[model samples]
Target: MSNNNNFRLPYFLLLLILLSSSDFLPSVFAKSQNPITDSEIKKKKSECYADIDSGLWGGHCKSSSIAKENCALKCLSPACYELIYESDPLEEGEKDYIRGQEYKYCMYKLSVGESLEGVRGSFDY
Candidate 1:
């Protein structure tokens, strides 16, 4: 009887884990399916611009023209945002500046009717 109880406890725990994981996996898949839309991009850029004009700049950017410009570019392109903000931090130096310029150029190209593939080369790095 003791051995049977132990066996059942492990199985019960495994079942609980699997059940909870199954519930979580579907939501992750659903979120991944919902891609960003053009309207959403426009709305975000408008909000960023408004923040810049009001000296807020999305609460993350610095209070300066160049910083505000970069913030707007981040709003314009998700890829740019990920590259500039999401990636690992670097020591503030020439490399950082060059990478920032590259991201800015990518976002600018996208704004000027360039294909995302053309601007970014690929969606994934």
Candidate 2:
């Protein structure tokens, strides 16, 4: 009985140690708030536009209009909108239209060999 009790004591101590130290372990699910790089932002913008185009043209959905609207809402970057047009009182549709135009211009600048960082910085706001 004493030998069995000795074995159980070590197991209980190990379990307690593991439980107490669990909070100190590195978390795999942690997210960083670091700003994204210019290239990464550009890649995301391209992907967003592709999704919008696909949603507009793809016939998988019941209504093409609804698909396009949903894709636009999902893909449009609010940060981009805020950065380009801060505190404007435009309606949602108008804002979206302006954002689209600005995005296209940014893409054109990128095609002409301008870095995304430079294009972003060139904007007035």
Candidate 3:
């Protein structure tokens, strides 16, 4: 029990740190006339299409054109979000899909503004 408590301590502290630090979190939105350029979107979509040509999803998701299109669309919409969500520490299980969910929310906000986090000046999340 003590050992378990010790393990939980760091996780608890990390959670606390993340929750309390404003700088650590991404911005909900930022003002931009156009956050995503059409050319940029096209480029991403093309890159995503190219990527699907050789990945595991290609072999597995190819038969289902809808699934393939959805996967590619996800990759292109928010490239970073898709990559991060796909590679999040938490795998697909229980509440592990939070990163993906947050990414979706982030995308929605990004569609409206350029900066996800209005952190005065910084590009990282």
Residue by residue across 1-125, what tens digits does model 3's lDDT show? 99999999999999989877786554433254455566776787678777887784557546555556657656765454454444533322335344545555465457666455532122234
Q: Can you tell me which runs of candidate 2 are displaced by over 4 Å?
A: 1-34, 56-125
Ranking by TM-score: 1, 3, 2
Best by lDDT: 1
How do the residues 1-119 of candidate 1 rate in per-residue lDDT, one tens digit apiece?
99999989989998778768967667645434445456766687888788667766455565555566566766566676675554553332324555565565665555554444543
Best by TM-score: 1
Encode model 2's per-residue lDDT on 1-125: one tens digit a residue.
99999989999998877766755443323333344456865687567657656655355322454444444434554544454444542343443554555655555544444444543445344
Ranking by lDDT: 1, 3, 2
Candidate 1, residue 88: the lDDT equals 52
Task: Using lDDT as the measure, name the better of candidate 1 and candidate 3.
Answer: 1
Clashes of 2: 0
